[model samples]
Target chain A: MTKQDTRPRPKAGPAEPDRPQRRKAAAAYPYAFYLPAGIVYVVIFLIPTVMAFYFSLTRWTLFDSTFVGLENFADFFAEQNLSIGFRNTLVYAVLTSGLKVVLGMLLGVLLTSRLRLRGFLRSVVFFPVLVSTVAVGITFSVLLKPDTGLVDRALALVGVSGHDWLGDATTALLSVALVDVWKGVGLATVIYIAGILSIPPDYYQAVEVDGGTAWHRFRHVTLPLSRPATYSVIILSFIGGLRSFDLIWTMTRGGPGFTSDVIASIIYKQYQAGFYGLSTAGNVMLFLVVSAIVIPLSWFLGRREIA
Target chain B: MRTFRRVTAEVVALVVAGVVFLIPFSFMLLTAVKDSVQAAELDFSWPTSWPIVANIAEVVSARDYVLLRAYLNTTVLTVGSVAITVVFAAMAAFVLQRRAGRIGALANFLVLSGLIIPPAIVPTIWLLQALGLFKTMPGLILVEVAFGLSFAVLLFRAFIAGIPRELDEAAMIDGCTGLSLFFRVIFPLLRPVTITVILTMSVTVFNDFVNPLYFLPGDENATVQVTLYNFQSQYSTEWNLLFMDIVLITIPPLLAFVFFNRKIVAGMTAGAVKG
Candidate 1:
């Protein structure tokens, strides 16, 4: 009986098997089914991305073209605003991402607490995210207008005059950055909501039973558990801030003598000025800068996940 | 004593946060119904009279009814782009995840590249022209679809991971082929996430300004956001109509949230919450 049971079943052989055939059949659907999407992925995305690299090396407009290797890239770095654009992109990315994470965590805690009118409060906080960037920019521009705007009138009520929020070169970028934060922090908040909500009740209960203070509970249990959400908030918000354009454009059009010009707006300005090749090079640089920063950062974050 | 102190602190914190976010929006609504001088003054006081109807009418009838056309264009663009993006992305993600090999890795990377890289506008322009789609609605639709596909794919892949593999096997045993199997079996299971993707993508495409500004530059192709320029002239700004324009463009998405804010947040964080 033991010898008979140890013998290989005839049904398990390559031709005679149910399991092997099913496994092979499972494998077949992948390639055959994935083919159409794969073809589209190549034609629409891959081909164009490769072509962009090539075009950055050429001088061209809507209809004109000529090969000019490295000249476009050279011109891009030499522009007066190029360095400023790079500096502003990094600065905005850091400021916006840093602030959003801190605020999001704070709000996440507050809203998730047994607070009053939680539903209404959450909607109010997330309200800015729904409005169009163009509309938001325009509304803020009017509201923050130095003399006639509400900000100034309110300041006047306090015996202080409002400063030129969007007019002065110094304040323009800062103003835009603030609005970006306002429009965006909802995303971080929502992420934090999910993260915090998922924490098992027993963890909190255990902390409380151990005579944990609110601070102690937050420090050990809430903070550690929400690391993934925090990481995501930092990465997504930072990347978004790096590529910000619409709000900046609608607010000031990178004006006040180009003080507010981000890389995207600078590229658009170059395009407007008929320097197509240079603009293309700027696009390439923007792509490289974001990729270089984000890929490494994601890898760093991913390592934290595994550990 | 500690509990009392904590409650006081919480109340103060909540009020401060609420005021900081609320005041700007309050001013916006206030200005929307004010006359030009009053609007420019930025007073937070109630309107001297109700100009809501009058101001909105002016905005609607501005630039030879341009805002109406923009509304139509944006509706078409948003509906078209979201429809294409959700279907294509869902299908691609399903295939990519089901298959595990070089092609899968390459597709995943290609999609990932979109997340980090800014679009190469010049090349995209050229590509559209090369395909004879430049300055066309179809061109804009394709552009939106290409850019949007990656995020949609990411969302779909993450959500699909939660579904059990046994369903696929059970369906295959019932004699369903490729499209039928996906549409009949897999697709229905994906409805919750698909709704989320649809809502988020619709909001994104509808709110998009730059893509429409560049790719669809002509007056006939103007989206509602682009129509803000109708009040903006090189010579002088029309403050009243412009403010009204801003208010008008804001209504749809604002209304969307009024109805579906909770669902949107839930949908948005579905994967993040799980992972």
Candidate 2:
């Protein structure tokens, strides 16, 4: 670790002993530092967000757009698979986020044990996260291909019939959710590692001194201290699930009759089908849906942080 | 003894965990090597003959070598996007962290919101069209930079915060100009975090499927992930070729993680842990 000298930077102006104007300006230096990022945020993100709402009311292709006044949204709702996509998005978000946090923490604790080859194990666990989403989806697409997949072969070893995981409407969404959990659990583990490491070992020692069991220590000390990590995992994973496209697109393309079509995939399908106005509406709905969930959650989390 | 039991339990747990993680990668590797029949069977067995060369040839030669073209496009996109993101983000973060006020607070919130909100794609397309940047590499590059800058700025802001303001002042005292103050005085000290930003940004831009799929449409500008469509038709998907495509696409980011995983983790966790 590099040792940092914590000296404050010397001011530019001559030894003018603490003028309010200079102090104000100097104190505002940080904002000056932040300006370029501010421009980027406004232009790229905020502008787009504001325009999405505006355009969602309009019927438009790439170049020419006209004010249609919520007709697009109505069309989106009126569409056959839209409702299903909406339901799938919510369910996928909840399941993937819930599983990721639980599995991530468990895996994190297991990996952090006083085991051999700890570094190697950590790397292994995190490897999936580094793979491209499309690649993971493609790999699993083959691996879960009912008849010839490795998973089916493994099932056959136990005298069980294997079914098409991605092609089956019943299993497709859940299968994607599981693969998401598999890929993303590493991130949650990373968070947990940082969280766990930060907790003073003395807490564990004190618990032990009090005749507390391992489970007891974990329940009272480890879990509470790791709340921040849990919160992070939930929020990040939920948002990811809501916006997930690549994996689902590659695997089944929301196939077997739109069984696994999350909102994002539905929107992409609209784009693919050349329903430009409808797809744009779907995009708006996705933004709105994510915002509706995330904002309140962020506020609640922020309040919790304050508490 | 209790100690012996604890150690044994820990070892067993570790081995089980390792197997869970390792098996998938093993599956990927074996699938890449196996012939069509072996692949379809999902046989965990060793390949009778290494079809690695043949598979690579097929994937590369598919769709007029679009996958190879996609790889080149990805490289260009990643490099261009990262360079823009790092430079612009560092500059932005420098100012934001240095200057403090209501404006700063508002700017900070906007950037944070960028981190949370899913981008509205349709409007973005319209905006691009209005700007006449649609279906262009530079347009996609700009879009990538725009999205990427928020996270980079956040990282850079936190890292820059730790650097005392004294250095900026001292440099100013020595008659350094605006650009010099940043380039010569402050920028050099940002090596660790800059490397983190670069590594993370590069991986993200390279692995990105959506942005390129949307912004850089057409075979001429198609990126690696989008090019995987070559293996898929209306009816059937070429599993062997698709897996090979997977191998190719997965390699760069995997290698990146192998080298810079620590930095990437540290960078990501910096704000949360430190706060």
Candidate 3:
């Protein structure tokens, strides 16, 4: 409702004498159009983010605060699980993003090829992406239960023994990361498919004309051309890996002694323990870590993308 | 031989993919119908007795019909948030795409930050409490909209960039000023992207567990996902009832995917592919 064209528009664009001022006032793109979204975003998102910075420096309940800077940050870093949480976050991000990049491109290539039941196969791979994470976590948890679970049972028939996937600390983080990939690789595949499909036929034909085999065509053509898709997948899934809480919460609760805990879960557990100040600090740390990785990566990716 | 090999590879891929993805769903469906003790085994075996109807009745009727309330709450949350997300995101994206200057660049930065930054939860809860929206549906709805806006804005911007500026010029020349021009002309043309936003945002909000859990706590106000989480604990040993709840809550997305599969896939892929 606060949307009215009152402010003077910024002076830019071509200096055409034929341009009319009234045309600039077109409703199709009003400064007021940004108002509704801007207000909600500022109030609900941006303001709180700023407030989180202040509150992270304070030791207060929802009601009152005592400004206790640096102490909360120190405690958060000093916590035993902090290192594991940070390390696991990196491992999970790298593992999921790395695997998805490779597997998704392969599936993208396969699905796009002259193949039977490709549609069904694509849907089958993508279906898990839409399902509830908690449901998938619970299902996989049961399916991975040491010996009786289907995964172990299935492995037994092949005369290979299965370890306690989620029960052991070594495998807990790895198992959850694999499930994250399973739930996500569909998306990466689709993105890669789109990227791969967008490449003109000339590129592949050129490769073939060079006496190149299918491997040469794929290795040379498909992979490099899909840089944008790879960037998209890496950032999306990697950030997801960094901030993931729900699946980890549902599956392990960061258990096996918090071996599988990530930054987001650590924040949640801190909050659950009523460590409001510490939790806020944890969130700030998480934001920094994510921005640290993503900002530079985006800069690097964008630099390459433009040239 | 080449054709045979291609077909053979396709068949093999389908089989492997089918088993990997489809088995979990089958297990969820099968386990939901079994009796408690039998369900606890968590094997892939079928139920000895089909108590699906009875199981559905119990899960629905459990916790003083909280699941029913949760379904209603979730429906309202999804509709309210997705509706706002579509309209607001489209409007903002329209402006940002058309007049992308300094302010637009700043706004874009904020939007991108929303995607990567893990929201500070305790502070969010504190702020919501100050606004008297804490543990309330409207508050949670706003939270969802806030979180959803970035992706929605990006998607709409990509789609709107494709809409010709000539339409705007023509509309403005006809005495359609400000909101009127957008409402009459540009907005109508945004149908494809709008549907994409609606379906994808609907799924995101409906399946959202964390926000509702953090912001809208309490029994009566529980979202369907929160109910699923709650049921997981109370029915920790009662796998049948627990999975029954999972199946119930999972139906909405399943239905959405089945019906609007193309739009959902397009919306998700559009941003990644094009951008």
| Candidate 3 stretches greater than 4 Å from native | A1-23, A26-28
**Per-model TM values vs. the true structure:** 0.92, 0.91, 0.95
Instruction: Give lDDT: candidate 3, residue B128.
Output: 88
lDDT of 2 by residue, B100-136 (tens): 6677787788777777778878678778877889899
lDDT of 1 by residue, A1-307 (tens): 1243456655544544464554655543545555544555555566766777878899988587799999887766676676688788888889899989999998888788877666777777888887888878877887778887767776888999778899999989988998898888888888998899889999999999999999988999999999889888888887899889999998898878888888899888988898777787878888888988888988898788779
For candidate 3, lDDT tens digit of each residue in B72-113?
A: 999899999999888898889888998766788998998888
Q: How many pairs collide in each candidate, listed in order? A: 1, 20, 1
Q: Comparing candidate 1 with candidate 2, which one achieves the higher DockQ?
A: 1
lDDT for A113 in candidate 2 is 69
TM-scores of chain A in all candidate models? 0.88, 0.88, 0.92
DockQ for all candidate structures vs. native? 0.55, 0.54, 0.71
In candidate 3, what are the lDDT values of residues A146-235, reduced to their tens digit? Answer: 998899999999998988999899899999989999999999998888898899999999998899988898889988899999998888
lDDT of 2 by residue, A180-203 (tens): 888888888888889888889999
Order the candidate numbers by DockQ, best to worst.
3, 1, 2
lDDT accuracy of residue A101 in candidate 2: 83
TM match of model 3 to true structure: 0.95
